[model samples]
Target: MNKLSCILLTLLAWLQYSLWLGKNGIYDFINIYNTTKLYENINDITQMRFRNNQLLYEIYDLLHGYEAVEERSRYNLGMIKIDETFYQIKL
Candidate 1:
């Protein structure tokens, strides 16, 4: 039964190949998982850069823009200019 044995061996080899290299196999799963993780990391870096740019702009505004300084002083430090009268309304 040498031919029968050869057929069974070929079938086993094909099954092994299908198991490892077929669609939705372990290699594909790992590759997709790694790609997803890489994209997630890239997105995280992009978001961090966006936040950094926003902070840099805010710093620039606070340093050079009088309106920003005035707003921050009024809201955060409870400050008013000498010529401006402070009025408080109770809610």
Candidate 2:
């Protein structure tokens, strides 16, 4: 009886050791984590919100005046007046 009990105790100890400190152990738990991805998503959301705010401001400016339209056309559409000369410089 004593020998059988000792063998069972040794087996139980080994299983507990593996469960606590071995591969797929509770201490590390590396494979199942997604906190980094969640943080990345949070950062992306903040950036998207900032971009949306900038777009909304631009929309408000465009709605209120023609100067915003002119500037947007000059820069985005590469437009110029009939008497104006367009210059390009590359560095």
Candidate 3:
């Protein structure tokens, strides 16, 4: 009876170990979950980098292009060129 009980306990322990920590086990599931999170973070960083690049290009255009500067000046500061006649139409 004692030997039978000991053998059964050993088998149970081995079975539990194989189920939870073996080749295809709970550890694998956790690793897959972590990997999915890493992929999502990488994608988010890539999107942010793309947005940053677009903003930088816009800044460069505003600094170097006369049309962009003129548009901003006309819209924000109500600026007119020296050669242009200023007209104020009253609503």
In terms of TM-score, the best-performing candidate is 1
Summarize candidate 2's per-residue lDDT along 1-91 as a digit string, tens digits: 9999999999999999998888888765654456667777778988988999999999999999899999989999998989998889999
TM-score of each: 0.54, 0.42, 0.46
- For candidate 3, which ten residues in a row score worst on lDDT? 40-49
**Cα lDDT tens digits for candidate 1, 55-79:** 9999999888999989988899999
Candidate 1 Cα lDDT to native: 0.92
> lDDT at 28 for candidate 3?
89
C-alpha lDDT score of every prediction, in listed order: 0.92, 0.88, 0.92
Off by over 4 Å in 2: 1-39, 76-91
Clash pairs detected, candidate 1: none
lDDT of 2: 0.88
lDDT of 3 by residue, 5-84 (tens): 99999999999998899888888889999999999988898898899999999899998898988998899999989899
